[model samples]
Structure formats: C-alpha cells, structure tokens
Target: MEPMDKDRRVPDRYEPGEGCLTTAVRLPVRIVVLVLVVPVRLVWDALAALGRAAHRTVLRPLGGGLAWLWRTLVVLPVAWTWRTLVVAPLGWLWRTLVVAPLGWLWRTLAVAPAVWLWRYVLTPVGRGIAWLVRGLGVALVWLGKALFVWPWVALWRYVLAPVGRGIGAVVAWLVRYLVVVPARWLYAHVLTPLGRGIAWLVRGLGTVLATLVRWIVVVPLVALWRHVLVPSGRVLAVVVTVVVREVGAAFGHCWRVAGIISRAVGRFLGTVLRWLFVEPVRWVYRTVLTPLGHGIRDGIWRPVRQALRTARETVRQTRRELRRALFGAPREPQPAAAVPPRREPGAPGTRTLGSSTTALTKD
Candidate 1:
C-alpha cells in the first residue's frame, strides 16, 4: 500500500496525454460546453434567485398567515367542537350508561354464575371424569399390550428378525460379488486412465484457445482501453473541468449582477409605490382620520357610553336597595389572613468564589 501510494502521489489528474488529437478535441469541446453551460448557468442562477426572493418576500408571510388563519378558523374550532360535542358526551355516556350497566351485569350475571359453576359443579365433575379416564387408559394400555403389542414383539424378536437377518446377509454377499466388485474393477482399471487422458486433451485445447483469445481479442481491447480510450477520456475530462470552472465563475458574476439589478428595481418599485399609494394614505390617516376618529370617540360615542353606564348603575343601585329592603342587610365578607408562600427544599442563593454549593454547607 505504501509503495502504491508513493507511485500514485504525483499522478496526473486530467490531460494525462498531451497529443494533437486531444488538443484539437479539447478546444472545440470546451468552446461548445462553455457557450452552452454559460447561458444555462446564468438562467439557472437567475431563476434560483427569483425563487428565493419570492419565497422570502411573498410566499413565506402568505404561508404563515394562511397557517394562522387555518388554525384559528378551522383547526381550533374543529378541535373544540370535537372535544365539546363528541368526546365529552361520549365520555359521559360511557361512564354513566355503558360502564355502570356493564359492570353491574358482569358482577351479577357472569361473575357469580361462572364462579359458582367452576367451584361447586365443574371442579367435582372434572375430577370424577379425570379419574375414570385415567383408570380406563391404564386398563386399555394393558389389554392392548397383551393382545396386540406382545404378539408383534414376539413374532419380530423370535421368528421374522432371524429370517430377515439371514436374508440380508445372503443379499449382501450376492451384491458384493455380482455388482460392487465388477463395477470397482471397471472404474479402477478402465475408466480412470481414460478419463485422465480425456481431461488432459481438454486442458491442452483449452490452453490453446485461451492463448488465441487473449492475443486476438482481450489484449487488443485492453490496450485500446488503457492506451487510447483512457488518454482521450482524460483530455475530455480536463476540457470539461475547465469549461465547468469557467461557467461557474460566469454564473457567480451573473448572479451578483442580477441580485444588484433586482435590488435596484425593487427599490425603484418601492419608491413609486410609496409616492403613489403609501404617502397619500399615511398623510390622510395622520392629518384627517386621526382627529376625526378621536373627535367621534370623545364627543358622541363616549357621551352615549357614559349615559348607558350611568343608567346601568342606577338600575343596579335600585335592585340592590330592593334586595336589602327584603332580605335585611347581607352579612359583610370577612378578610382572609395572609400566609407565607411555600419554600422549596434547595439552596436559596447562588454560589460564588467564596461560597460552597452543597445544600448542607450554604455559606
């Protein structure tokens, strides 16, 4: 790895081969890609800037206002309605009607009956049935052993087993002499060396074919890839890199210029809008409407409001008098005693250079 790294340390990145053909191709390809990529990069940068401006100036505030309006108009109201009309009523109904009745019914009908049946009836019946089943299982097992299992066991152990063993020995002897011995002889004496000879011939032919293919096809292709295509690719890559760098630089310059022009235009538009609409509205609001609204609020609206308030107070006083006359004066409210607020169990003061921070040592 260290040797390979040393060898590759000063490797050429692009333009590895400097030749006439590469030079010719590089010039034209750079010129074309630059021309094409310049306009594309400029347009892309402009559009991207415009998109950012629109998102920042127009879409962002609009989206925030829409979200706020949706929350206020739709989401909050729907949530309140669901909580008030659906969830509250459902919760109340589940508690008052479903839970109470279902709980009572379960306790009265299901629980008591199931418990009684399991304890008083099912337990005794199950035990009796289990005891009977266990006795029958034992008896059946012994009877089956005497009638079926013993006969089969005796027949196999005493009679059929010996016969089967003797027959198996005879068959083994016949198979060894008749089939296995001849097949082994044929494989060892005849087939093995023949297979070896065939394999050797195949290997020799394979070697020749492999050599021919390597020299005819693989070597040429490898040489073409390594010597011709790689150098050409490197030259093309260098041209592409240069073109891209130029285009990127051009895009940076163009984007800066576009932003400057955009800001200038925006300022011009802002000035025009201020003169045409904003100034008149601001002047009118300050000069005319402010005084008029203040006059209306003070002169007429306040007087009417004051009159209504006086009437309300008078009515309230009369009603209070009538209540006092009927119910004999109400008892006065007593004042509450002030109590100190709770103190949490922690150090009250902050620690400084001279103080210890532990709760037990507060100094």
Candidate 2:
C-alpha cells in the first residue's frame, strides 16, 4: 500500500484551461441556458403572434360597428345643420348689415367727429396753448434780445477796446525795452537751441520708425520666401493663396447673408407694423363707418349737449336761489308805506297845497 501511494503522482493544482473540472462546470451551464432560454423565447414569440392575430380579428368588427353607429347618429345631423344654417346666415348677414354699415359709418363718423372735436374743443385749447406759448416765446425773445443784442455788444466793445489799448501799449513798451538787445539774444541762443532740438528729435523718430518697419514688415516677408517659398515651391504659395481667397470668400458670403437677414428683419418689422396699425384701421373704416357715425352722434354728441343743457338749468336755478336769498322771496308782499308813490312827481297831491301852514323849514 505504501509503495502504491509513493508510486502514484499527486494530482496537480486545478487550472481552468487544462482541467476537466472547469469543462464539467461550463458544459452544463451552456446546455441549461440553451435549453431554458430557447424554449422561453419561442413561447414568447408564439404568444406575441397569437395576441396580434386575436387583436386584429377582434378590433376590426368593433371599429366597423363604431364607425357605422357614428355615421348613423352623430355625423349626419351635424353635417346637415352646418350646411343649412351657419354658412348661409353668415353670408347673408355680412352682405346686408355688416359690410354696408361699416362702410357708411366709417366714411361719415371718422372724419366728422375728429374734425368737429378739433373745431370745438381742441382748436380752442390749441389756440389758447399757442397764445400762451407765443406769449412765453415773446418774453423769451425779449429777454434774449435784452441779454445778447446791445449789452453783450457794448460789453465786448468795452473789453476789446481796453485789451487792444493795453496790448498796443505793451507792444510799444516791449519795443522800447527789448528791441535791440533781448530780441537778438533770443534769436541767437534760445531759438537756435529749440530748432536744433526739434530737428534732432524728428530725425531720431524717423530712424526708429524705419528700423521698426524693416524688422516687422520686411523680415517676415524674407523669412516667408526663404522657408515657405523655397521649400515647398509653388504648391505652398498656391495653397496659401487658395486658403486666403477661401477665407475672404467665406467672409464675403457671411456679410451677404447678414445683410439679407437684416433686410428680411426690417421687412418683417415693416409688415408687422402695417398689419397692426394701418391694415386694421383700413378694415375698420371699410366695415363699420355708418354705425360708428351714428354711435358718435348719439353716444357722444347727444350726451355732451344734454350735459350742457343740464348745466345751464343748474346755473339758472342757482341764480334764482341767490337772488331770493340776497333780496326777498318773490311771493312776499311789501307794506303800503314802504311802497313808492304811484302818481307822477309833476302832479299835485290829493290834499290841498299849503293846507297845514306848519312846516319844518322855511326858505
């Protein structure tokens, strides 16, 4: 037994690629999956087909019955009513009432009311405003004339006369003080130095600008010729030119597209404005002129006149109340003594003249 055990080699550690155990584990799993998954998929497919077939068979008759019922009950009456009533009445009413009244009213009402209102209310108000404005304008013009016309001219002459005299005096003084010595000294020393400095600065700047131009603009051209032109020869030049041209063309196309878009936006805005303001006004005038005219006459003019009449009545009532309050009520009577004489002053009294002889004063 010991020799048999020694003679038998111990089994090597299990390796997946080289082991039978792994094959045993994998084979059953694959077989199980194939067995289970295939049947499940087939059943699912069969059930789907059966469900679709049943749905088609059942739904067709149901749809047909529903359509037939709808045709019999709902559609027929609605179709008949629409054809008989709505379309015909709209056309007749539009022809008789809507279009005709609109045209007449707009023609009469639009211009007349605006013109009348302008004449009555707005014209007075505008004239008053214009008068007020003109008064203010005249005041401003008077003020401006006062401020600028004579005063400024006199002030300018006064100031300029003194300045001119002073300048002339200063020039005379300067000629007396500096003509011989100081003028010659300034020209010889100061002006010579200033002119030389200006010339030197200008020449320096010109030299620096020339150097910068040579370095920045000329060096790049030389390098391009040496590296790009010589190495790639004509192809590089052609490719660069083509690229630049394509870029320019693209820029031009973008500009054109932008211009077209801008024009389209402008036109769209113009069209929208026309539709919103102008076309609607035109349609309204065309449609409802007579009705609008009647409405204005009845609605606005009548009410305004009625209001003015009511105001006048109120004013008369107020005046009567004021008179009664200030004086006395008209129904109240006066005493006989308080009343004035009924006979003329030239007529004698009923009693005899100088009958009593007792008088308060003698003349």
TM-score, per-candidate, Cα-based: 0.53, 0.26
Q: Give the candidate number with the greatest TM-score.
A: 1
Q: Which prediction has the highest lDDT against the true structure? A: 1
Every model: Cα RMSD to truth: 17.3, 42.3
Q: Give the per-residue lDDT digits (tens) of candidate 2, residues 1-363.
A: 011232243423334464443444444544544544544444544566568777789878889999999998999988888878887888899978999999889879897888889899998999999999999999999999998898978987999888999999999988978796788898999999999999999999999999999999999999998988788877667566655644454444334443344445546766998999999898888779868988999999999999999999999999999999999788757666776444534344333243453234322
lDDT of 2: 0.72
What is the C-alpha local distance difference test score of candidate 1? 0.80
Q: In candidate 1, how many Å is residue 66 off?
A: 11
Per the 3 Å backbone cut-off, how many clashing residue pairs does candidate 1 have? 0
Task: List runs of model 1 lying over 4 Å from the truth.
Answer: 1-110, 271-363
- In order, the Cα lDDT scores of the candidates are 0.80, 0.72
- Ten contiguous residues minimizing lDDT sum, candidate 2: 1-10
Reference-based TM-score, model 2? 0.26
Which lDDT value does model 1 have at 168? 100
